[model samples]
Target: AVESEAEKRDRATREIGKRVMEGWRILDKKCDDCEVPMLTQGKDDDKGECVLCGKGQKKVLTEEERDRAVSEIGRRMLDGWKLEDEDCCEVCDLRMCSKGDKKECVACGPVLPPVNVNLELPPNFDFSDPKALEALLLQVQKKTSTANQVPPTPALSEQKEVDKVNISAPNTPNRYGSNSNNYPNTPSSMQMQYPNTPSAVPVTNEEMSMIGAEQKIREGWTMMSRAYCDCGGPMMRAPNSREAMCVNVHCVNSCY
Candidate 1:
């Protein structure tokens, strides 16, 4: 059986929630500096920076200098941000403040590698299958580390071009929005085409949309029975049963 529109919507919402939780779990073991989710990294303690896109690289404190780290974690927890048990030190196997037997033993080294689970979500899929989603997410960390693999070296010309763009036009409009010189001027006249207008006008429909209308129209357009306020905005809910309202708060005559 095909999923109804309402069923699809509900399933979509649940799928979104599942994906969000996936992302949230990813962040649960993220490196502060690199913003990299150390999916299968052996040790954890806000390690090295990627040095490229890495921002806010937190300083690593020695095992003896962990008092400040505990304080910082405590402060974050107090600020309404939830610090789960898993948020605590994975290697030490201790709470931010707790000084116990290091079961995982940071001093000894990581006994278990970080769980590295990844899922590939398409634009559209049969979200009705929970088992498939679970299977997609069920991934395990490889025992061997691939960190030894070197980053690909770009061609000198390509590198120079990239550096030139970065140095010369660092303030591109796409990067800094309308404040940049690269911003294109917005056209004064543009047709207002709405999606619902076509959806509302079905087979054997008398209404024709003035969508993409280049010039000012005089006639030949049939107005629907749907009433819009004189404010040129759609009529909305009114305080009284007798009154019609213009939803725009800035309107001079909001209620009629």
Candidate 2:
């Protein structure tokens, strides 16, 4: 299909493939003077010398190599280096000189003279002022005193009272108890006692009730047995209970 003039112009301006362009290029010929490959003007102009540097054929870099070279050059430029041109010695191709300064080349003059030096001094620190030294010592002594001084201990109670806790049952398993022999009983004036031992301290009614409750719990009570419903209704035993559930009718089979 024939493209329109504008489309044709756009397509013509677009980049051509390297392979196609290379294939279209006429083969280059080696220049006789430089021995470098020179682009042939035509098939008839195959044998010739280089146009620019007539000594030898210059090797043309591939695209990838050229890109790498450009990247390296850019990296060097970023790191404060650049390619610069300078005039070299036309005769020897290198510029160098000797003696004290730049005038004749190294071939004509003696080298620079040797150089050296020597000196010595004693090292010492000053702290001889009695007033200043005394002040510094006083400051250090004050800091040491402040650090070493112990704070006064605070009183824990107005007066010490012996702990009145009394345990009578040697057979009773309590996690808090640590006795290996028959229990000791100290008759305290404040404690109320049971008739079993007049020598033992008395247990009040509240203590007796607490001990009884603890015993009851140790015998059989469990968290599931104490289950309460979301509505706060007390739990009742379910037959064949696979999981703990509430007793409320409103919460059928719901977990407590």
Most lDDT-accurate candidate? 1
- Could you tell me how far off, in angstroms, the CA of residue 98 lies in candidate 2 after the best superposition? 24
For each of the candidates, the C-alpha root-mean-square deviation to the true structure, in angstroms, is 25.4, 43.2
Task: Give candidate 1's whole-model lDDT.
Answer: 0.31
Local accuracy of candidate 1 as per-residue lDDT tens digits, 1-256: 9777676456544643354334312123444443333332333333322222333234344644343333333333323333234434443433332223312222222234333334455667454566654444342112122322334323121222221111112322221133333222212111221223342333111111111010011112212124454534334332234444443222345321
lDDT of 2 by residue, 152-218 (tens): 2221111133233232344542323333222222113212222243333343322332233223223
Residue ranges of candidate 1 with Cα displaced over 4 Å: 1-17, 20-95, 98-118, 139-256
Instruction: Give per-residue lDDT, candidate 2, residue 185.
Output: 29
